[model samples]
Target: MIQRDHIHMLIQINPRQSVAKVVNLLKGGSSRVIRTEYPEIEEFLWGDSFWGDGYFVESIGNKNETVMRQYIR
Candidate 1:
């Protein structure tokens, strides 16, 4: 879900995939699309990057899947 200043996503990653790599792919890919589709965004940017430098992640178990999905929603 997209919010005013942030977004919430509930994703399940493969065991071999690193969270950092996933975040990078998501940010980098989305940045390209967003910038290409809306060049006006450059006016509001403070730097060269579209996304912030930091990200927050957490690990959830099957028992808490419902709770996590609710939180993301």
Candidate 2:
């Protein structure tokens, strides 16, 4: 939500779900929306994929909130 290629977000998921599932949902859903909304960008995307195949995720415990917030900022 912060930039075109990167996002700064905080989300809470169910304990049963894995982080990879969340990443896939976000990337897959956004890719569809982006391609549908902006047809012109199709040519610039890599092999019909808008987002890259990899992502970075970090879990911040309550004790590490300050450290994570400062790092992200």
Candidate 3:
């Protein structure tokens, strides 16, 4: 999980569970934790009283130097 004010998650888990189910669970738990840390973060975590409505999932591949540097920076 990568979190700023919002978040970007890159997860690798077992194949038995459906991705949608896993995403919902993770989103719910993370949202709760974020709220605990900073109540104000709730607004960012759930813009307009909703957390992310969509997610992008992909398999990892060889690192792109440009993207890697951007992430580190």
lDDT of each: 0.90, 0.79, 0.66
1 or 3, greater by lDDT = 1
Least accurate 10 contiguous residues by lDDT in model 3: 41-50
Query: Which of candidates 1 and 2 reaches a greater lDDT?
Result: 1
Q: Judging by lDDT against the true structure, name the best candidate.
A: 1
| Candidate number of the best TM-score | 1
The C-alpha stretches of model 1 lying farther than 4 A from their native spots are none
User: lDDT tens string, model 2, 1-73?
Assistant: 4686688766778879999999899889988998889999988867967787788876666657666666666
Give the better candidate number (2 or 3) by lDDT: 2
Predicted candidate 2, C-alpha RMSD: 2.4
- RMSD in Å for all candidates: 1.2, 2.4, 4.5
> Tens digits of per-residue lDDT for model 1 on 1-73?
8998888888889989999999999999999999999999999999898998998887776557888878778
What TM-score fits each model?
0.88, 0.76, 0.56
Ordering by TM-score: 1, 2, 3
